[model samples]
Target: MTFKEAAYFILKREKRPMTAREIVEIALKEKLIKTSSKSPDRDLAIQIYDDIRLNGENSPFVKVGRGLFGLREFYEQKREETVGEVQHLIRRLEETQYRSNSPSEFEEVLKEAFSFLGFETELKGEPGNTDVVLKAKIGRDESYTVNVDGKTSRSGKISDVQIDWLSLEDHREKTKANFIVVVGPDFSKGNVEKRAQKSGVVLLKVKDLIELLKEHARYPFNLLELKRLFETPGNADYVVEEIIRSHRDRTNFLENLKLIVEEMENLQSLLGYFSVDSLVARTELGPQMIKSVIDLLNSPLIKAVEEVSEGKYVLVIPKRELSKLFGRLASACEQEKEQKEQDDVKNKLVKNELTKDELIKYLSRTERVPTVLREILLPLCLKHGVVSREMIKEELVVRKMAQNLGQAGLVLSTVSKAIGENELLESIISYDKLKPWKKDNFRLKEEYKEMVHAVIEELKGKEQPKTDLKNRLVEYLSRTERVPTVLREILFPLCLKYDVVSREMVKKELVLRKMAKDLGQAGLVLSTVSAVIGRDELLGAIIMYDKPKPWKKDNFRLKEEYKGLVQEVIEELKEIKGNLQHGT
Candidate 1:
């Protein structure tokens, strides 16, 4: 294993923090890590430090002090104990002679305190500037620099005017340090505590620093934790505790979702079409908590809830319908295979004189031919009469078949042979220097079109009557209850008059002129229809052309299947209009 993996394994096994040197020593002795670096110990140390710096609290290693490390949980517990001990020392020193020192002596005492607390101290001697600069590691991932200004008073109270010129903000602007601390006898006048709060400046009592120095002298402590106590707002212990609580809450939420899914096959089925309030009450969950859980279960992949009405839902499983679909697909595959075998025999009989019917049969039997290609080739042959080999290649590339010219040529060569063998195309010109061979002028024979039309009618006889687009729209509107009653009355007549409706028509006629509410309710109604009946199916029912330029003044007309339903809605609207005129 590498140094990082080896160090993590050892730390996890020991259940304690180990310094880089100690970790390397143990890993080498136990044959845990394989490395050829001459300075393996230094390499390991650098790796551990980088991991801690990059991953922060998520890192397995936590810095205990300068050059000391431990497991994260152990470090957290030890940190609290150290901070509490320092707080006690601060209280003790507040009542001593430590507060009655001169300014220079006070600076010396603060310097000593920081030095003992694992900080590298530098005294900055200049007029109207910070007194001392202290650098310390905050955690495995963080290091910080702080500027300290010393203030002394024999009365045990330092006035705000003495330190007003040395605001944390100005000092930070000049020095670009992470934090600024003011070490003084005490800030007891001019609302110093409130000032400190507003400016984010750390206020340290002279006695507090002396006590911390004395405590460190007696017993080593984690200076990082002490730094956090001074820098972090509010109780640092509570902040750390909340971090742990949040992590636990996240883990529990995920586990709860997994357990709930296993216990309830369809959670919404318990109470069909219920609201968010009912879910919370039934599950005994926190009022704000059930929404996220319900949303997770309602995702499209899970399909846990079917929205039967707005703000109300029911559970449904599509397994039975899915099974039926699979069965139909399997039957279709068998039919395609049988049809292919029959076409092979038919092709053998008319190999030289291929009719349009035979060509359609060949196309229908061919698997994986892109729909766009079929649409392009069939129309061009029927209209243009003649098509060149080069033209075919160009069209194929334009349709994104192959990436470039060379690849398109390769694909076309393969497809050309298939077309020629089926007798749908005949070569008229031989290959030469100027151009490649060309195919004869082609058109779909009348007899062949008649034969295909007959087949379509036979299939239509076996098919069931499809659901009408207008009826689907009405069902969706009824369920959502989103459309205003007056607007609904206007929309029925508009759809009937046009036999279809576009977004522009709905916006101008129904929303702007009739409703006059300055709302985009028409778009919302169309979106609901799209969602309920699928965007593709709804467009297919209303759009006149297969390849529609919707942005180019296109007029959508109802398909033959849906025209009858449009007429029905139109009749209903006429009756309503008659009643209104008669004052019934």
Candidate 2:
């Protein structure tokens, strides 16, 4: 192994900081690393030094003291050092909150604050516009804008200023914003409060905004949670405080996680394995709390526990290893969060450099695909390699995804921005001249077709062999003895949309080699449908006994309110396995 890799193993196993010489000695003694040099310790130290020097904060090795090194993974977990910019910005905001000789200066700081919280901010320079407009986009479809009226007061209270409560709504309407708020150092009682309440405007104090900044700088970045800031028309402090309470609850969960993991480690020695309910009973704790802790242990970063039975779990890793993982949870989470944000900026900067595999992977994963592309366009693309631009609008209308074509176009535009350049967009789809960015006949590039077809099959409920199974086997064995889960999932969604679906319709849908030509397995298919919809109800479904003596059902009808259950089943069946998850 390399010097750095060996050092990492040693540091993680030892769970403590060590000098380079000590690490080298251990590596050599255990044969974790090989080196023929007389001064192997000095060589390892030089390699680590060079790594830290080059990568700086991103290095795997961090200097703890004179010649002492530790894995950066478990180093100081607090985000205080990294949140320097936020700290400085908050200081400037606090200084200017009360009284500002220069309104633009305060506006500039406010803009920085908003931008820091992941909003696109613009100082409305025009006379009629609000002081600032802040826009936030949630995913591809939903977006909201905030018209912020910045008030500066000589008396450190907004009552000193001529606050226009009347134009707030007009300003929101003019700016096409979802919400409008008045931001100041503080507001005097009576008139200011009365006017804001009457205008249905949110009175946001600088201190509350500062509180949000402080919270953002902490371990849990809650910028998205702060959406409640615009949701209610009142003091925004309540929203910020509510978010803080959530973080506090998360803290409690973390403590519970410690208790659960440590207790599970002890119990594994005594009981071998335990279920969530068993753990709850043994500890005399709530099942929900134990289950929630189990969820955390099963997270991607910390896979300390694995389910041995249906609900019973066993500790997968040793207690020391688990402890080592959660030791630096705060810093590790912060680093990962920061890395993703940086990667997003990097993705946008690239001009449609997505590969064929990447395109397929993006569309196949629900999180990666925009809602329009996933729910509307891609489904049609699966049927036709080249779906027309109008087809997308039509599908959106049919599905009620958008109110009008104009809104559909906005949704498409958001998709365009997400997918990147027009060159890339047009390469995939035939485009119209007017809104050429995302509008066009959606088509797959020739290179993307083969892999995309495979993904299309996967989306169409093509199941894999046993190991790719996730409750499919157990559910299938117990619930429907003969019918396959995939066959049922395909028909389930279709059943929800229509009152009466027949065997002939299912046969037509499976025109491909998906089903056999002869109706040998027809009974199994009918049995699967009946098993889901209620077999007792299937007795009524039988129209009559034919002259041949066999009973036949004419149509498939999902009893009312089964739509939600049907959709859930379909989603569970289509849970993508293998490479689709986080690009593997």
Candidate 3:
């Protein structure tokens, strides 16, 4: 474990500041400060501590107050604290010797000490309060927002002087949240400890913070644990060291490391959607944006993966998360590959099977193929030219023949050829042209006559309805001059359910329903419904559908009397207006 790692572990586990002695104890217990056989009783842990403290100022580990060291820079940066201010405070702490006991009334010293630790200090926020808060991110794939009250204590509990506060429940509700740091020398009684235990919030004290700084110099925790130690600088070093040792089984560690790496890479890729560079470099993006990306990469939700390439990473994760992410990626790649193949086919068809003039003149007019299917073939068309088009047609015919053995291929020619015979021979000039014909006897029995006949009949009786309501409607429409609005309320739903309604049907229905006086008014009513209401009601009354519950909200059905009443009112109003105008 590095200094940052040690500091992180302390914060996460102990939830308090740690003393140099306490940190040394933890290091010995965990065997973090290694000793050679020749130097068995030489206090290797203290040596590590001294080294950390010597260069602790402005280093990864920083002294918070007297005898308390913490990974201040790590937490401060995690919480987006001012680097310069933190450096200044650390400098001040190095020079000024404050009492080892309780911090004094001299606010400047307190402010400087906070500054040294990189706390965003606000004086007299709403008055009568001196609150110090520590904020930082923790977690692999989650935003573990921790807040610590800045205070120190002999009881090894966080202080009640909350620099920031949020309920524990709120914190827990967060995708990954831990604590709200209450920064002080000590808490009222065991309030800090109780809350911390109950809410799973860390409590850091001044001394604990100091020791963390010391630990960070030798063996530092990752961003997450480092943040927690600073949040509540208690005797966190021991707790964190124990955690590291207990969990440092080689197999588990390697597995976790792999998982973290993979997750971090995935996170980086997600961030790349916004055009962010890798954590290792400054992209073209602004500094703040880059910082945010780095923050995201280091978040608990995103585990740090090993770098595979420049701006490329593999995630460090277990099989489950990896499986899901890989599955999605694999699916997307397959879809893209499939689409590419389809496009290649189409392009080949265009390039080989059709002449440039033919493609330009007639390809735009072709609409039988769906856009998705055309996309598939576009590349093929581009590649093989006219030959690919023939291939596409042959494939389609083959598929159809496969499905139905008796199926015959359609005359695969343009509209121009169907309408004008001379253009067909001219447009298609090749040795292949004579293959389908036998000179003057080229006129084969028209196979498409049945399809054409069906189309003609369909057009002739387009408005014919199987229901008797249609005939009665037509007769009533012939008698009526004006449409009654009441009929629309009923007809709209019917049109929607049975896709058999038309403009003539609407007019006829109005008369059949006794809602119109004459056919002219029915026509006018149909026109009014089509034009003013924008063809909504007369055509169909379909409730906009959504998944699972299409009819959840909308209820469009109109009662018969209510419809009649509304129409009657409109008629009465019109009559009244006409009479008043005449009288005037």
Candidate 4:
């Protein structure tokens, strides 16, 4: 018999977990198998692992621990307890979906899905009221409810003939739901789909809903953001795709950040500075971000990147501690992961987790911006166009999310993450933090204000929430001019002399000019001042120059694409320098 066969025999007899080595030895001694293979234990372990992973539940072999194995039958005897879990409800759904008359059970499953999706649900009478009422809280005060109806078919297909369209509307009116949804296994082509579209009811397929739930478990959506799905009309597939896109973006971000933190910490450079471009080119993991995006990471919350000169930056925390800090920050910036369960169902997702040690080890390396925070700040950011750390902190505290200053500060730490989320829409159109080194004011680029307002318009749909209209933000873009001393005194002199500036250069200038009180604050204000004059983009080009210390590069390389934007801005900046020289 083969080693795998022998192991099955040995395991059945042992009735306990055994390491691959122990199993191989027992099989050989008993003469259950003969192997000429040099590493029989290794071979057996691979076979067992492949069998379990490949065959899934069908595989008799079960992994016990590192290099250990157990029988599936052994564990099946002792089932684990759960806390009103969604997985079991889904399985129950699978069973109920096939039965023609089990509409009630299907309704129950849909209710479970709503709960799992973090909605406040109520299951009511079938003939009279809607099957389910789903209330979702958008912010601390804003909330809206959805009407849900489940359709079941023995043939696993639902046609318009099977549903009461007028009755569904009646249920919607009676229930007073902001929106109505009809969910079923399948729908008839012409009438069912046409009526759903014509009447504005969402016909959500069971399989599609299940897929959304699985994706939700993997990358839990902020309830406020998830509400976007209900507000959107048309196929349920659209909602599924929306959630899928969000999940992919977040997963990509976490992994990239982890990489940067780990890589920068490794250098441990004496000067403790590196170019962003060279770093991205070498690591091949940097996301497409503007230079001022540096300000986000440089914020008090993350403190991951410190932009010293034009395009140079240093990691504030080393690799070992960075991983731990990320774990804590990711947990703090968690986006509504409370109701979702971490399950590994064969076809389902394994839930988005940022705490894994290998940095997860550098995935979301840059920042961990929670979706909830993005939702909270969306309208506020759009209206003001210029915000302070205090304003953001006050918003979070008033939202009743974080209690007091400390908790509010924890929530605010994810502001770097917020920058990331909004930046994906349009890099320059989003936040350009002017003072990341301090808890101070920052503004958006004036040129991109209109485009940003359009993006904001898209996020906030036609249907307005019924919450109090207290925060009716202004229609016009607003920013009082802010020209800090660092912009004129410290940064300009160095910028004129050097194509590529170092953190050291700016620090010395700050000390010489007596613009900053101390070296510590001087270091903080380096690239920060340039961000105000919108020269941060030039620094992005310079970021690519560093190729590690041995081949250390100091020359500023302006990338082809950024050349035009940089030249135009530099001309305007030179005018600023001229004004300074003229004492006007």
RMSD of each: 37.3, 25.7, 34.2, 31.8
CA lDDT, candidate 1, residue 372 = 24
Pick by lDDT: which candidate is best? 2
Overall local distance difference test of candidate 2: 0.63
Task: Tell me each candidate's TM-score.
Answer: 0.26, 0.43, 0.21, 0.42
In model 2, which runs have C-alpha deviations exceeding 4 angstroms? 1-78, 123-127, 140-142, 221-224, 277-285, 296-304, 319-584
In model 4, the runs with Cα more than 4 Å from the true position are 1-86, 140-142, 267-271, 285-296, 329-584
Candidate 4 lDDT over residue span 450-541, tens digit each: 33344444334522431111112110001122233453344434454556666677677787777667888775565454443334432443
lDDT of model 1, residue 350: 41
Those runs of model 3 whose alpha carbons end farther than 4 Å from true positions after fitting are 1-140, 152-178, 186-192, 227-584
Q: Global lDDT of each model? A: 0.54, 0.63, 0.39, 0.58
Model 1 quality (TM-score): 0.26
Model 2 C-alpha lDDT per residue in residues 189-268, reported as the tens digit of each score: 87777777667788889888888777666644444666677777767767778877787766666656666777787788
For candidate 3, which ten residues in a row score worst on lDDT?
438-447
Across residues 1-584, which tens digit of lDDT does each residue of candidate 3 receive? 65345645764576554544466457658866554432121232233344443453344454343334456544442122233334444443332223222222212334444434334443321122333332333335643444332333344434444323344344334423344444344455565466565555555444444444444332434555445343443335466455355434422433343343443455656763222344324223344544443344446645433345554544444446756665565656655643564355335433332343343333222233221122223333334322323454455555442133222223333311342343422233211122233111111112222222222333335323312333443333233233333333445444344434455666776777766677888766655544433334421322121222431212223333123222333344455558888995
Superior candidate under TM-score, 3 versus 4: 4
